[model samples]
Target: MYQGIYGSSKKHESDLDHVINRAFKSGVEKIINTAGTHQETIQALELCSKYENLYTTCGYHPTRCNELNESNEDEILKQMIDLCEKNAEKIVAIGEFGLDYERTQFCGIDQQKRYFEFQLKHLISLKKPLFLHNRASSQDLYDILYKYRDEIKAGGVIHSFDGTLDEALQFIQLGYFIGLNGCSMKIQNNLDVIKQIPLNKILVETDAPWCGIKQSHASYSHMNTQFTSELVKKEKWIAGKMVKDRNEPCTIIQICEVIHSIRDKKESFDELCETIYLNTKHLFFSDQ
Candidate 1:
């Protein structure tokens, strides 16, 4: 996902399969590769289907909404929906969709809203959870998601959440789950926000190669581990390897550790990890 816009140039193959295996070896039961465009969703689903432990979400990210031009918008959308309909068994969620005010240069706010609502309206028929995104647009995202709350009865996840406690509470109130990554632990206030989240309402992710925890963070020592030799050799591998500070799925354990350290003392460490893991499974792989 660290690739350039569209990720169309990413031609590496069978690489993610290795990553999936490594994640499983490291005690990760399942992983979801979210899509931001037609090619990405297709590629993600295809890759996910190869591993029982892997799943993918299908939808347009707000920044990439413009990838569908006005002339071919309807047709392209139908194509995406048809793809989803044809492969609903492999697709776990409807997004990586929502407002992103931070990227107004990539797509106008109005355009983002248009496609976001469109996806939300159609997500009802897909009968899957949502993989939501919101960067400096929680109010708008919440307003829109609220309108489709009934349709999104399967619940949703606010992935890579770095929002305020109030934003987290609002989403939790709606029965949505929060996805935290190392990035969320970057700021003191963000760590404080995490402390307020209930164990059962939270999930952890690496947002790999992007949201890896800072080495300077106190929890790194206990949570950090060397990347597997097999993973370290693969150029297109997931998570950080020994060479550099890339985010890897295995690092999720670190996110868990960091969270566990700062979280409310409502649950023991084991209980907290189990609860978050089950929350993720129930939300994304309930059908399984």
Candidate 2:
């Protein structure tokens, strides 16, 4: 939502309230707004305070790691920790942070690894679960996470997971949950990997308004359902209408339906939904 719909620079502000209301009406019980920078983290917390059942994460994304340097890294880390401490009730995790090797042009490998480890080392003390992001840097990401496994007692979710089955198993073995979203089902292999994830260790998300499923995705064949909201191009967006190609939280049902179609038939659709909901609660809202 921060990157696409609700942020200061986004164009869909006129329909923001409608979109959020649609999500809750569609049976979305809670929303976790992920922050990718120190500034976004603050914004997420402020936004969460205005709405019920809304939560946020705290940390910088790998692609935005360049914002840190020897001069400001310590101050930024302090600021993140202060936000977590002051608003512990709303700040559920310590990420949107991890390695994204695919976009090294935005921030080089050395910087990404350095700050990824830096955040992991510093933020683990907060005892919050992680909201991680890993793209094409699994081994290095795993190594870093594995190094700090014992300290991460709350566990975490690898949000928008797009890794091999072996990699998924490794993260699960480390007691992490695999977060499946629209982007997670983009290809045949993605579907295959998600199919093998144990039901108890899976969480589903929209990762909106970014990872909405597309017709070209392998999982689209299973999506015989859709939301009825009118779609319009962002340039011609109207209040109460969804922007075309911009994902919203209400589309999460389609994601769950796709998972139901691809997973073992032994579990009914309601059972699958229940299992994923419980998994999410276990990781991010266990105290409640």
Candidate 3:
């Protein structure tokens, strides 16, 4: 099992440590983190190195590409590249890299695109799997991905998935696996998406410190005919549940619980464990 911190929104310090330790106790032997910045990467590496199971994924997040200051862009990129090369054995992937139009606090599309392409080329050369991020930029992202689909034949997931069934089908066609997280359980539409997704193509994540599933307080919010109502409710629940609890990696068990509830099989745990384990290995360990 994978068991390291996620480099998304900042998780509570104690919670982060709790998740890592709990996962370690539960027999998780590896984890892929998205250290979206250089400092964050270094800190996580320092904290998690004691555990032989922990690993890191370093890159700028789609929404945080603006954090890549113009003056420091080249230097930061070089540092990231060097870190990846130096710790190639420890850093398994190069991402949380993609496009996010949902939040414009970051740079414009062009800048995001530039860094994304740069990282793609870098990882392709390294022949590593990606820990991707894409939200509200699926079409454009898909278009760009298709161009390099063959050249960057090593595939990755669109993390914290929020795309349509058709869009997901397109990704599968391109040899990408879909990442299902707590959002999958809290969001009913994603629940529909989850049911339809092939067992072999699904992987689970918490995206913790964010995207927590709020099953307890959100079970009965009324909704309009449009799915938008439910989507909003779900997003709120995911955020509230995760953050309210300090959002840690060990919450992966909560993620599994939600998945089990949706699939409605008492045996979901065993099946899910086996399928997700195999799926993760198939994607990340194919070359191994």
Candidate 4:
């Protein structure tokens, strides 16, 4: 089985090892990771190369877009770009970078503009696909992408898609695939959104160690549901019931479950898996 893993983790906590171990044990042999810093990307490369199933994408995050101006940014970017050029056989995509206005108010638009454009330029030259993360700044993100759509040698994916069907359609038009993860299964409203999206444009991700779905009812009662007064408690608990474990790639099955439920056909599991595997291979490994 082939699976995609997205994140920007540092060393010592690089979960790729755990994921590689589990994936191999479960008959999975491929993973695509998104790296935060130059050093992090190098570390991921070292680890993934050892495992043979792991691959990574290198880029700065929107929150750390400021790092692009640091002294190390150019040195690091050069190193990463050279690595991508020499080891194009190993890297899969070029991001985890985009706009995150919700989390990066201090960075300002210009900083994001400069860094994002810079990374996009490198991505264009490298001819590698991307893994983008856009939160609340989809308008400008789409604007830039559209302006350069034709020039982008390698199209990419939008990770953790949370936009409306209309917005989702926009990205689909640009040769970008939508990455559906556990987050899609958490919000009730997104269920319909998930159902509306076509399966061919979809790819499953876990975004492990973060972005897991939980039933809010399960969390509130994890310790005191029994002690609470009956009058205070409603017939049905809706706070938190199921907690998603952090940092395990095997949980990708949960994402498949969401797709199966929304598509309303169980037989699609095999087809779905094969389709996603083909999608990934076509997008990243076609030229390889």
Candidate 5:
């Protein structure tokens, strides 16, 4: 909810309340608002205060790693620690952080790695589960996390995962969960990797305002149902109606539906949903 439905700016600010309420009406029980910068984390905390079920993460995203440097690194990291300590109850994770080589143009490789490790070393004390991100930099990400495996007591999730089966297994073997979203199910290979991951190691998310499932995606054909909300262009925005092509938490049902369709038939949809729900609770909401 930090950005408007369009995601690039605050053009659709008025529609946010309706969008969140719609998600609840559509059966989404909780949401974890991920932040990529200090300011965004503050905004997320503000939003979380407004909704009891809404929680958040605090850290710099790999693409946004350029914001950190030797000059401000200590100050920024201190701010992150302060935010986590102050909002420990609401801050469930210490990321949206990790390496992202696919978009290294935003931040060079050295800068990304330096700051990513900086946060890992500095924030591990929070002992909160991580909300990780990885894209085309799985090897580096795994290597870094593997080094700190013993220190990461609360474990983490490789959110928006779009990696191979081996990569997924490696992370799971490290006691991390694999988060799947529209982006994770875009291709046939994505579906194949997801199919092999055990149910207990999987967590589904919307990655809203982005990663909306498309008809062209391999998993689209497997969806047995669709979100019934009427889709309208952002320019033609209407209250209670969804923006065209912009993902929201309400559509998370489709993610579960697609997974159920692709996964083994031995487990019924209800059973699969229960297993995933419990897995999520174990990782992110264990305190509750």
Candidate 6:
């Protein structure tokens, strides 16, 4: 990935591969890498093409709305569609696309809306499930997806969902699975909302190098992993083989642990993990 917000410097090329290998060793079977801009989409495609277990999505993020206007829309859409179509077996989804009213100042609401609608419309022809990111624009995002629900043959996932129970339920009604990451489950309310969601509709992700557990409602004292809180020195932490303060794929297990803490007592720990793993596979890998 690019090393900065301006996207100037680049990180080590093999960094993602190293992290992914560490994650797979820690019981992670598959990963869905997100590509929200033209550059990101290209990087994701290259990585997915190299690793069988790594899947990727191709679309422009709402934050990058300014990056896509009438000038580059046609070229961007064609590149995304062409890569997805040719590598349909590995380039599994089309998203990281949605609304973000929070950052409307950066890119106007109208422009973001237009860009979002364009991706949705074009993706329909590709027949891929969407990997969406919605922040404070649920209603608009929902309306757009609802309008094209029939055309979306593979359905989609609301990744790193931090919406209300009602919003979650609304997406459920539309037949999309809700994705949960560390930040998504940081608060007690997050846990409460997740409790309301059926296990069948649950999907867990790392959102890595970003969404590690900020704070769990209950103490992680009982966490079964050796990478405990003691290792998390305010800014730096180590889990499995990957070492960094930023979230990494290996820590996905902690996301599952957090979910288990708030889950109903009816199921055993292993059973719950199996259920969620299968649900994720069903959402992102069922077609493959």
Better of 2 and 4 by lDDT: 2
Candidate with the greatest TM-score versus the true structure = 5
Off by over 4 Å in 3: 1-16, 69-72, 216-244, 264-268, 285-288
lDDT (10s digit) by residue, model 4, range 1-288: 112222432212233344467656755557777787676788778877787768888887788787777666677778878988877777788887888888766577788877888888756888788788887787888988888898896888988888788888899998899997766556666777878788788888878656654546211111111212311111222222211234346557667666766667645677877888788788878865
Task: Give candidate 5's root-mean-square deviation (CA, Å).
Answer: 1.7
Q: Model 3: clashing residue pairs?
A: 2-30, 3-30
Q: Estimate the lDDT of model 3.
A: 0.68
Tens digit of per-residue lDDT, candidate 2, span 19-60: 888889878999999899989988887778788888999998
Q: What's the distance in Å from true for residue 130, model 4?
A: 1.3
TM-score of each: 0.86, 0.95, 0.80, 0.81, 0.96, 0.88
* Cα lDDT computed for each candidate against the true fold: 0.77, 0.88, 0.68, 0.70, 0.89, 0.77
Leading candidate by lDDT: 5
Candidate 1 wrong stretches, greater than 4 Å: 1-17, 217-243, 264-266
Q: Which stretches in model 6 have alpha-carbon errors above 4 Å? A: 1-14, 216-223, 226-241
- Listing every candidate in turn, what is its Cα RMSD in Å to the true structure after a full C-alpha superposition? 3.8, 2.1, 7.5, 8.4, 1.7, 3.4
Better of 1 and 4 by TM-score: 1
Per-residue accuracy of model 5 over 1-288 as CA lDDT, tens digit each: 324534455555576788789889888899998899989999999989999889999999999999988899999888889989999998999988999888989999999999899999989999999999898999999999999989999999999999999999999999999999999999999988888999999999999988989999999998876764588777766677787788889888888888998886659999998999999999999978
Alpha-carbon shift of residue 2 in model 3 (angstroms): 18
* Residue 221 shift from truth in candidate 2, angstroms: 1.3
Residue-wise C-alpha lDDT for candidate 1, range 1-288, written one tens digit per residue: 334222455423434444456578889877778788888988987777677767778889999988867798788778878988888777788888988998899999999999999878966777788899999999999998888777777899998898999999999998899998876777677887888888889988888756766668544543535444634433444443332454667667878877777754466878888898788878887766
